[model samples]
Target: MVTRDRCRGALLGLAVGDAMGAPTEGMTPEAIHAAHGRVEGFLHTQASGTDDTEYAVLCAQGLLAHGRRLTSNDVAAVWTRAVLSQDGGFHGAGFSEMGAIANLRAGVAPPVSGNDNHESWSDGAAMRVAPIGVLCAGDPVEAARLAREDAQVSHAADGIYGAQAIAAAVARALVTDDHTEVIAAGLAAVPEDTWTARLLRQALDVASHAAGMAEAERELYRRIPLFHYPWPDSAPEAVALAFGLFAAAEGAFVPSVVSAVNIGRDSDTIAAMAGAMAGALHGETAIPRAWRTKVRQVSGVCVTATAGTDLVDLADALYEASQGNEEYENAT
Candidate 1:
């Protein structure tokens, strides 16, 4: 049988890491230090959520609330509205956050603009794709396909592709027995259509060698690390994130996430996206206890774990979704 615990672990692990990363969102390294005096571990309270995981949960809720299956149009409509709902407005990377917003800026009507760049790439989609993967665990292809549907509202190019990677990883995790093979397959599933894919592979190779967040970011960026432009890359921050997680895939889950978030410009999004990928590989129990203690995504009316879908329950649902009534739950 598929372990509900694993799925739960993956989902909660994701949410927890998302929350942990949230506190530092949009802060420069210096700013984060000034605010929290260098967060060595979880701070024991809600640091506030960002638009990353919030967008995903809200996007899914919007679909369920509307009682609609995912369509590019539907995804785009909800995504645009969601971005507009941002409290102070997105200060950075909104156009690149989801390619559709750029069209909106150019005066495309909401409904009409939804399909303009249906296939454009952005990382907005990649960060919140875990649930789709969790729910569609039975068929990896279907998982990837559904995840693309999830991302259709916002992500395109490498962003959409990154969602495909996470979904496929979680889907395979539901059905696999081997840990090494599971992560290996998860990395494999991330596509080679762009530089992000190439970097992911490079990261997987050097994941263990890096000493800390700064080094990992440099290795992932293939940059010569320095105080100035330590993480320069040709790829977008979202694209760099996909590989950053892969490069730092070893050791403690929370630390891995913290390191990735600490090193990069888009701290929360990178940690959140990478956390989902890592959680899918390792499960909830794999996450550190201290990080969970300090996160806000674990509690709140707005971000409640689905009533029957807390970490363990969510994992069980995916396992059942994949296995159906089969005793062994093995499709292969």
Candidate 2:
């Protein structure tokens, strides 16, 4: 039951959220308010997607090339050829990706490459995993498994768990309208004792009790204990915040993404994750026309090869690929 509308919504939502949130990425909620009151729409005249959108396209391409047979080695090979082989440095890429690239340059491989990287716990993997969910629609466990295959190339521990959670959530969302079920699928994908699980639960609790977006933001800031590190790209934090805001907005596309953007701290990634889930839940019609139009094509800022890539066409291609795989699996 994975429709093309929902697929389009998922990818377009990711791009819209990435572009809309880019301007206020590092600023606090108060700073965002001071700069621009409650960013319900695009900030700039011509909003452009950041690393989040490009990396997601990369993930989609990986899924397109390998389907359910995708492996960590396949992911590494894609990274080497599509990413590392390019002359220009990774524009606005995350620390974990940079570390993984360095490892690849040194002839090291995944699991080791990811485990040895210092920034393996960042949200890099989670940001680009929505495509796994798209390909594994209605199958959260399968989505989580595929997500791990991709995450192991550049992430470990909480990073992998966060990617699994988002992928599972999106997979569930693609088949069901129940936001609670989507959240449950995400939680089920991760271990109960892990930091990602704990934070996700805490974020949901905060979202459930809060009266409005403002109160939810404040409560999230108070309850979620961001690490003392200088950077604000922790996988657990970003994923938890995105899910919490999705809950707060009751899975509405615009509100979910806007809430994540307004909450600040890794805004682009958080908003992109929230937007992906919300878009899947509601379908393409739920997203505003203007936002959809703006995100139809990527800027290729991070991954230059993704420049001029039309997300609408990509989504259709992904849906077609998924159907082919499903047919193959049924016949087998």
The best candidate by lDDT is: 2
My TM-score estimates for the predictions, one after another, are 0.69, 0.96
Error of 1 at 231 (Å): 12
Each model's Cα RMSD: 6.3, 2.7
Tens-digit lDDT track for model 1 on 1-332?
Answer: 24665566566666665666656655666677777775655554535445555555654444343322556666656655655444444533434444566766566643345346643454566667666666666456776777767665555556666777666766666555444554554456566666567656656655557776566655654542222633322223454454455446553466657665555465666676567656665666777765543442333323233222233433454455445444322311
The C-alpha stretches of model 2 lying farther than 4 A from their native spots are 225-227, 325-332
Q: Least accurate stretch of 10 residues (summed lDDT) in model 1?
A: 300-309
TM-score of 1: 0.69
- Kindly list the per-residue Cα lDDT of model 2 for residues 1-332, writing each as its tens digit: 67989988888888888899898888888898998987888978889998889988888878888899999888998888878877877778889989988998899998888999998989999999998888888999999999999999999999999999999999999999889999999999999999999999999999999999878878887777484768889999999999999998888898888888888899999999999999988888899999999989998988887889989988887777777744322211
User: What ranges in model 1 sit over 4 Å off?
Assistant: 26-38, 59-69, 74-120, 175-183, 190-193, 208-218, 221-243, 293-332
- Candidate 1, residue 237: Cα displacement in angstroms equals 4.5
User: Judged by lDDT against the true structure, how good is candidate 2?
Assistant: 0.88
Clashing pairs in 2: none
